[model samples]
Target: MQTLSTDVAIIGAGTAGLAAYRAAREHTDKVLLIEGGPHGTTCARVGCMPSKLLIAAAEHAHHASHNGVFGVDYAAPKIDGKKVMQRVQKERDRFVGFVLKSVDSFPAQHKISGYATFVNQQQLQVEQADGTQLTINAHRIVIATGSSPFVPEFLKSAGDRLLINDDLFELTDLPQSVAVFGPGVIGLELGQALSRLGVKVVMFGASGSLGPLQDEKIRDYAHAQFNQEFYLDSAAKVEHISHQGNSVQVRYQHRDKGLISESFDYLLAATGRRANLTQLRIENADLTLDDLGVPVHDRYTGQCGQSPIFIAGDVSNAIPLLHEAADEGKIAGDNAGRSLKNAADVRAGLRRTPIGVVFTEPQIATVGLSLPQLKQRGEHCYAIGEVSFEDQGRSRVMHKNIGLLRVYGEQGTGLLLGAEMFGPAAEHIAHQLAWVIQMRMTVPQILDLPFYHPVIEEGVRTALRDLNHQLHIGPEMVEKCLDCGPGA
Candidate 1:
């Protein structure tokens, strides 16, 4: 077996692993990056980029079909499914190529193209693709193996007819009809996109909630918007799934609706994701694992137990967004390089104000804290400010006014807390609110900032102004102004 030694060993070559590898390089050149799966970051390969491409195509087709209101009377848009998929793949490959090119700057020897197994806390036995073996010993280790889509046992018999995000993007042709078995982010986005592209899609969720969103107003608005586009049956309990030739049949019972059985060309198992930790051999590391088998590491430090090993990315399961993964990776890499005792001093805290965006017709975005989070922490004294997109002038002009925006702040101090919205350009508004919350700005302080007129942002200003009026500290206090130049 070939033996290798490094200052830090990073597992997986996805986003978090790459970030950790880069950060570890700042401290020492002795770093080994081992990847078991395909190259290119998850966002570029299958998660974000290709999915957005699909959504963009669907949006164009939808707009073209419904342009009668704009005085531009055009025939229904013709969708060449194969061509659309080809374009998505072509562009997706370009993005993956760019990510691969970035990795080319690092020395080839520093990266291992293989699956790594933990022989001990500080040692890994890597098995290369071509029956080669390498033993790597590292002073510190970062587990950024990322995650994989979870499929239930009931769908196992469907085999090739079952699709996940990994295979969905590579489809050469669109299915005539699809049944998506999760109304979460992936399920809702892909389900709506398929419906817009002229495919019959039925989305089923475990609960009435569309996704991870906890707010009632935003969820109701989003659910209503989506129900108008495609069939949605949340509160469904899947009984069984059977494959017959090219199609699959799904049997489920809805809480409101009675027993229902549906057949479709494809079955998409968008039932969330689980961390890739089976090969890590955590027993060797002597870490306390939770019920889900994930290590009980500190969310802030990413340190696993009292050992020199750290965990990051989707594997940590603290927050699974791409940006959060990168940040955690940097923190893990930085802390891994330090002495075990001193690592806690430099440990980074997870961002309290979480931000996540769901790219639908009127995008859904949640920023800062959620109502459930605040209640779980026993801090529920908050007020809300809201505005409907139907009232926004720009939205009305664009013929895309279909959702609502709500902002939350502390009741007494008027400190900005969180926000959830389903509206046009909600992603941008969410980011602005996230920044405001990160800066710990109050409602009046945010209102003090300038707001441009005649834009969708003006809608945000209206919400802030509404919230400012509710606060006790705004528009009611004035300080003395000295007039030195005036003759008094």
Candidate 2:
């Protein structure tokens, strides 16, 4: 048995926990990061960083298969799934190794490979894999336990039939057909990845609008590109599964369309995710859970309203994006390091809204408030913008004219409140809008800023000009309407 103490103890070395470890070092001398799983599941490890590499590789194959429009026609290249999986592991290993080595700079007092059990407030019993027990005490704690994939109850006790994001790369061979549940980011990203790799994917989800967090235009545009059959009002209830020689048969009943049995090599349960907080012992930590058993905390600093205890990452009921988790964690780290919570409303300087990116081909990127959501909330907002991919010189050069650039604003101010771009470099535009929306920069202010021309960035300027027109109205609003009207 061993004992350790730190100024702040963080559990889970995922994105939030890792970022928090770095941020805590700014205010405190000692920060401890704990992980139950090995260091292979974080963003730098098996999450976005690695999964995206596989997705991109698969996309290259897709582009090769459909080279006719791009003027480079070619037959479908042989896809070596085993080789692709090998590269996936190889790349994930290299990147994750570098990240793990960087941890030495923070001097983690104990990076235990064990599940932490809270014996009491600020005290924990760490159970190592080798059956060794260690005691740890801390002045403050941040529960960054992250999230686990939510598998439906019926998928339980079934082996190899149902899979999650982590299990995809482990596949030995590609499935002939795949049935995907939920149109969330992970599911869509993975579904598209496999679909691009020539998997016949059928998506079943209750949401009429896919990627509900994104702009309506982007969502509609992507739905057009997916080329998959949508069981749109269908909530699948998996009744049973049977193995017939070599094929796996799935018996499911769609709520809207009655009973149906389908045979696929595999089924994926990507319905969503819930916090991995059960082993953390919430009662022992004296924490409260919402209906989902996720720790209830203030959206800002992630403080639970309990003294010296805060939460971060998916467990904190945040939006569960890596960047969102990292941002909230900086707040939690500051809260944990402080003796009296001296932080100035930790989310004060934080961006007022979130940015989301769906990593599908002709990818979707959106930041700030969506128009429908704004209308639902009855916000005094109106969006004026033009889709400008038609005029981009670079987009023309690439022959990748498949998406839109739309920006939204306050009713008449032309203040750029939100933006969504979904074409080449759409993710780059999303990153830019995150800052634009955060600072509440108006179109004029953004336009005045230096922007190089003959670039896709010009799309922003064009949208801004149209927004500016809507703002000023050219001092001829009634005159213009009157000329257009029958009375005129």
Candidate 3:
């Protein structure tokens, strides 16, 4: 057996895995990245990147279908699904190739096709694709294998038509009709996209809410606008098939409303995803797994207690979102490598705050403790303010005025704890809010910052004004402004 040793070993080369790999390499020379399967199956290569491309194409088609709204009239836009798929696949291929090339810079070794199983506490028996087994011993190991789409027990995985995010793109032809079993971000975005692509889409959710992080107002607006049929409060009992050449059947109940049946061209199990750690044999490394088989790690350090092992990305069971995975992986990689540099006193980075974004048109983004979450925690914070995109000149000029920005401030302290924004450029705005929360800036600090006109940033100025008004600081500031100038 070929034996190897490294300062840190990272399994999974996806977002978090790559981040960890890069960070570890920056700190030390001996870093190894081991990955299973073909590299294209990663989220960036397959899930998020490809899906977003298709979603963007669908969104463009949707906009073109409404040309009259923009003073241009047209018949419906024809969706050439094949053309869209071709472009998406091309993009996915280019991205994966680019990422692989970039990772070559780090002082790290890559094992493209290997199944790593723990042979002992500090050694992992690596089985290559061609049946060659090797052993790699590492002082610290990071599990960033990420996650796979979840298949609910109620939904049988027998048929080929049923798809997850990974398999959704493999279809030779577009599904005429689909039943998406979850109304979270994935299902909502894909359902809307498929609907625009001439696919009749229905979404099923246990609760009435669509996206857990989505504001009710925004979700309601989307559900009302889209042609998607939502089966809220409905639980699927068992989705099965009698035989081939037949539609997939779903048996569900509307809580107190009893039973019902529905059929569709395909069923998408967008319920959620769980970590792909089954192959790793976590027990062999003295690491613990949660009910879903995700690794248990300290939130601050990304370190698995009782084991010199850590995990980031989907394996950590944090938000499972892309950005969250990236940041956690950054910390995991840094900590793993830094541990060697300052083995006696190294402390990993802590995630005191998290930002979330759901990429829906009029997309929504949030950071820190939300109002309800704060309320639930008995946090008395009363600095509440909201700004309408309609009031912003930039949004008006861009014809993207359908949005709202809400800020929750600490009652006595002017520090911002939470911010939620929905509308055009919400993703960009969310990052700015994340900085605001991270710094815990006061309202005065925000108002003092100069922002240019005819830009979405002006929205932050408006939000600050509203916050000052809510705090009755605007009147006081205006009175002080006259005499508080440089001359005064």
- Where does candidate 2 stray beyond 4 Å? 1-5, 104-108, 212-214, 228-246, 250-261, 340-353, 376-380, 388-397, 449-453, 471-488
After TM-score superposition, the amount by which residue 12's alpha carbon in candidate 2 deviates from its true location, in angstroms, is 1.7
Least lDDT summed over 10 consecutive residues: which range in candidate 1? 479-488
Q: What is the lDDT of every predicted structure here? A: 0.83, 0.71, 0.72
TM-score of the candidate numbered 1? 0.93
Top lDDT model: 1
Candidate 3: stretches off by over 4 Å? 103-112, 212-246, 251-262, 288-293, 350-353, 390-399, 451-463, 475-488
Ranking by lDDT: 1, 3, 2
Candidate 1, residue 98: lDDT: 94
| Superposition TM-score, candidate 2 onto the true structure | 0.85
Expressed as tens digits, the lDDT of each residue in 139-250 for candidate 2 is 7888888888888776543456777877876666677777777777777787778777777776766555576445666666666656532343333456776655445576
lDDT string, candidate 3, 1-488, tens digits: 78888889888888898888878877887888888766543665757787788888887887655465668776788878788778888887887777767766544355446988876657888888889988898888888888878887656642765778777776656778888888777887787778778887767776666564544554565455443333433234443432135567666664456676667878888888777878888778766677776667787788887566878888787788777788888888888888875655446686756787777776778787776777775645466677777656677765676777777777667777787776779888888878877887878787787776558777766676677777666652232123323211
- Model 2, poorest ten-residue lDDT window? 479-488
| Residue 268, candidate 1: C-alpha displacement in angstroms | 0.4
Candidate 1 stretches greater than 4 Å from native: 253-258, 340-345, 349-352, 377-380, 469-488
Q: List the residue pairs that clash in candidate 3.
A: none
Candidate 2 RMSD to the real structure? 5.2
* Residue 413 shift from truth in candidate 2, angstroms: 3.8
